[model samples]
Target: MLKVKFNCFFWLFLLIVSCEKETVLKEPVIFTLSSDSGFIGSQLIITGSNFGSDKNKISVSFDQIEGKVDSVAVNKLFIRIPEKLTVGAKLISVSLVDKRSNPAIFNILKSYQVSTVAGSGLFGTKDGNGLQASFSQPEELTMDKKGNLFIADNFVIRKIDINGNVSLYAGSSTYGHGDGATGIAKFNQRISGISMDDADNLYVADYRFIRKVDLNGNVTTLCGAMNASIFSALLGITLVDNSLFVVDIGQIKSVDLSGTIKVFTGDGSFSSVDGPTESAKVIPFKITTDNQKNLIFTEFSLGSKIRRSTTSNVSTLISKESLKLNGGLTIDREGNIYTVNGDTIIKIDNQGQIELVAGSVAGYQDGFGNEAKFFKPTGLFVDGSNNIYVCDTFNNRIRKIAPIN
Candidate 1:
């Protein structure tokens, strides 16, 4: 019995040694991964270890993507995510047989936003896509409290709400030709511009005709004597302290809550003989109001444009710094004004300093975004995210420049 027991013990000890040797000699596969975290479009890397060349042999699990993923490389995996992923963190993991790893994490960021200059002469673009291949001729654009877009088309006026919903505020398509927006086939009798006051009432200037549309789309013709006429093109209008200021020819006309008219600029009519010779600049295109109640506007025809009291004592915000200015202008929450000068999007500081944010997108019409050429850029507006929205007229699109950070 003792001999048998000793033999069994020796065998057990030998078995333990063999198992230890086998455990230490096991082979391992190499694997690695990295991610670029700050782009709506991003890439993930998997390198160093056991991965099969066959696309079917590898499997990946991301927070929102799963697949026999496209192999960007043998070691580098390129992942193009959806735009909606911008609001969340993404984690990716890989598994082969029973071996698995903790997920690699990344945060998605907004690449850009979309907006249009009020009356930049370009609409949201067809297909309702602000960027895609689309068609729209916009006269003006404004945003409501909910980020809904109000655009004045040459013959009709439409509203694009937060969800990309478009409803007609006014349309001439159903009626005989009359002076209004959204349907006037001709600009001479159309709603040249539209806006909303602090009271949330929608105001539209139809050539020489001024009217207001309520939230329910009911239209009421406002004061016409102050706005009606041939030379009064009723191009741009802004609201300040319960008053509406309309830009006609070279003059800025003020209309009050009571429908009273007052001449704020030029000779009060197209009758003013100014420009080049007179310090009085006429034919300024769009009008804007600063938080300080100062009237900010732009002058087309490539001349000097500045903001001053009705008496012309102040300096110009849109200067003749030799830029061929056209289209729309906007002042941001920080008091910085953005303007379109030729094909350039110019950012002017509160101190009157200027910087070229994006320009000349037309030169890069090839869509390469190089040289930033703009074909007759018309409108400019910015969102809370600091994304710049440009109305590229001839391009017939609204392009958004999102902050890269």
Candidate 2:
């Protein structure tokens, strides 16, 4: 009886050990995915079991499209979603050896699309240019808080409503310097640059004058003379706080609401020199303000350069190399500068790295991003959504570049 009991106890101990080993081996072969939706070129993380340690042996597929494997471990894998995948639902799976994990559903985000927002052809006075908008040498443009666009069209400043109706905001058909109501005031010669203050009033620089037009169409000449020491043929204007900055043939000046004028840059001579306000500036074009309220402007001379100025009236050249030929400097929220250089849109980051953002060849063709062409494009504006608005000068149209998020 004793021997029988010992045999039974030994057999029971072996069975219990075998059950515990089975439990350890069975750890649920089920694996889990991190996310169900992602955008193109986005990195995705996947957690699973028995994925193996070799990255080369690991393979991942999204909607039958192979993803670039970034890392792989025994229980986790990382991959970058393929950029070329179509925008829609996709099946994602991970394969290791002959064991393929269960497929998961992933949705790709929508891509960007570029389109023409205003104007149809070169110099059209007829309404119904794309969105009931017309252009006759539209130069400078600015958007209001409501998304309405204000454009400087030759002798008159036109306002395009959100519904695309074009109407005169300031200036008349015949050009002459007169400060009155919007319907009575006239912009002599040609209007160059424009900016708006928090009060919804627009500050316009026309020829050798800087004028202010309020929301009710009241026009007031801020501080500029026909041929005074302040400016001569002003081309750009930017407002910071209570001060307004203007760029003319070779000078940048600041104007206060009280009509006080101060030369911040240039000695009224047209030549490239890096120094304080006593030095010369070579044909400065567009002017903008960075987050720090520093005045940034672009030059159009053969060896053009972008420069910045402090409120203390000190000037500093930002680029070591020449900008060569550029137009319309605009800054994003992050202080990155965007301008047009020889038919291509160039972006200069805060670190001073230059990159081409749009325009493939110099011509007149509006397609997708870099694949699109431009004709001496000038005026550039970035909206809150980062859509780039380009004033295709020679083409006589407002083109938009929408980025794929």
Winner by TM-score: 2
Model 1 bad stretches (over 4 Å)? 1-134, 174-190, 225-231, 268-282, 310-313, 363-373
Instruction: For residues 1-405, write the lDDT of model 1, one tens digit per residue.
Output: 999999999999999999988863112133555544544434445564454455555566657466335673555554444344534577766655556555666665434322332223334333343333233555466776667666664456666666655556565444323433443422234455677876567777767756787666666667674334634577778888788888887677788878788776676433323333224545657777776877777764546464544434334555565876667777788988877777777778878887665654444232212234666766565667565666565655555555443
Candidate 2: regions farther than 4 A off = 1-112, 128-131, 228-230, 276-283, 313-323
* 41-143 per-residue lDDT for model 2 (tens digits): 5578888676767888778888677999999766778898887788789888877656677877888764444577778665855555364566776777888
TM-score of each: 0.60, 0.70
User: Per-prediction count of colliding residue pairs?
Assistant: 30, 0
lDDT of 1: 0.59
lDDT of 1 at 204: 75
For model 2, state the Cα shift of residue 157 in Å.
1.3
Against the reference, the lDDT scores of all candidates come to 0.59, 0.75
